[model samples]
Target: MIERSVRGEAVWIRLDRPAKMNALHLDGWRELYGELDRASEEARVAVITGTEEAFCAGDDIETLDAMESADDVSELAVELRRVLFGIEELPVPVIAAVNGLAYGGGCEIVAASDLAVAVEDATFALPETRIGAYPPYAVERMAELVGKKRSMELALTGEPIDAETALEWGLVNRVVPRSELTDAVSAFVDDVVRSPKESIRLTKRHALAGKPSTGDEDRIAGALARASLSEECRDATQTFLEGGGSEEE
Candidate 1:
């Protein structure tokens, strides 16, 4: 579910499940957290990207639909927070190298990363509402990055914005042609690692200090559990899995 390698002063983590457009299940999320943990120990910078035409499509709808109890939903929410918060608390900067679509939880990952670079063809959205669900982590993170109004526009509308629009909204740092993506990411990595490692760590810590807290995971998990078990979500998910509804976000 994840591929990790050390490239010079950076560690590159790639999502490897192209068959599902790299959508993550529980095991995949756990694997990602392990990679991030390893990156903190091994590299000065970390870059996350996906294979082929996808960066990540987000959590697997099948997994979400199969969540049978409040405990399952709560565990999912807790694990999601661990990964997202792990990115923030890591000693080195984490860069999301977006190659294609980023939707739902995928978009939340972009928002949580310290910085991001994207191919010109990449797209982003918080389309959970279309499935009668919502992204637990993205609400506060998107509001922090793009403000409440714009964030609401995304979460409520379930529409995708282009790479250029993401840049304009402050979700990504740079957008380049697909061919230039590797070089673009390498350039950022080089610039970041040139600074002393401790300084970089301290800078990230100080920067995060200014951000508003989103409270505890319990509240977030409860909201998701309620939504996931709702009649609307169950009906929407069933329709989607049967291929009779819109594409899974």
Candidate 2:
């Protein structure tokens, strides 16, 4: 589930499903969209984070297992893509406070955010290829942020990177000690929020203006649909969920 709270001009959006490492199901995505929409109305900046030991693990395995058709897969992918895009287009800057592991869609969230600050122990990866699926948004945004070569390594290798590597690769803007993560983010947001709101918004818009359009949503949706319906993907996901394969391993 998603929890929302106000902290002066910044709103905090926390993913609270600690038991599952804050992995979101479809309903959770819907709730997040609603929260973001509402928060955008009143907040000058938004900070997204997660509870317990994870910023977010990714999509829920149980939800993925329950998908029965290509159309189902496509619909889920499209909705998630839209939500991430919404975050990107927000008038105010969105900061990801990556406290721990961020994988799959969680990594996509970091890619979409305007800025990110991660704890030293936090890790990031797009491991969809491990289960025969591909992260559609990451295909474009990761490459946009980290360039083609590094993006290819992350997408194709299905391996996790430590916070230092993530910072060196430009996945995150800064990495701080776990104990100082919150203060670092607070200071960063405070500095950003002190700037004129219009200038900040315009700066974000101008930075986004240089991004190349991929126009790959349909192709990505098709790929996700195909992969989600594949026997290998299904079996691999089942094994992982049943404790045969660890996502972090």
Instruction: Encode model 1's per-residue lDDT on 216-237: one tens digit a residue.
Output: 6999889888898899999988
TM-score of each: 0.96, 0.94
What TM-score does candidate 1 reach? 0.96
Q: Runs in model 1 with CA error above 4 Å? A: 244-249
Candidate 1 clashing pairs, residues 3+ apart or interchain: none
Candidate 1: C-alpha lDDT: 0.88
The number of the candidate with the highest TM-score is: 1
Enumerate residue pairs that collide in model 2. none
Q: What is the RMSD, in Å, between candidate 2 and the native fold over all Cα?
A: 1.8
In order, the Cα lDDT scores of the candidates are 0.88, 0.84
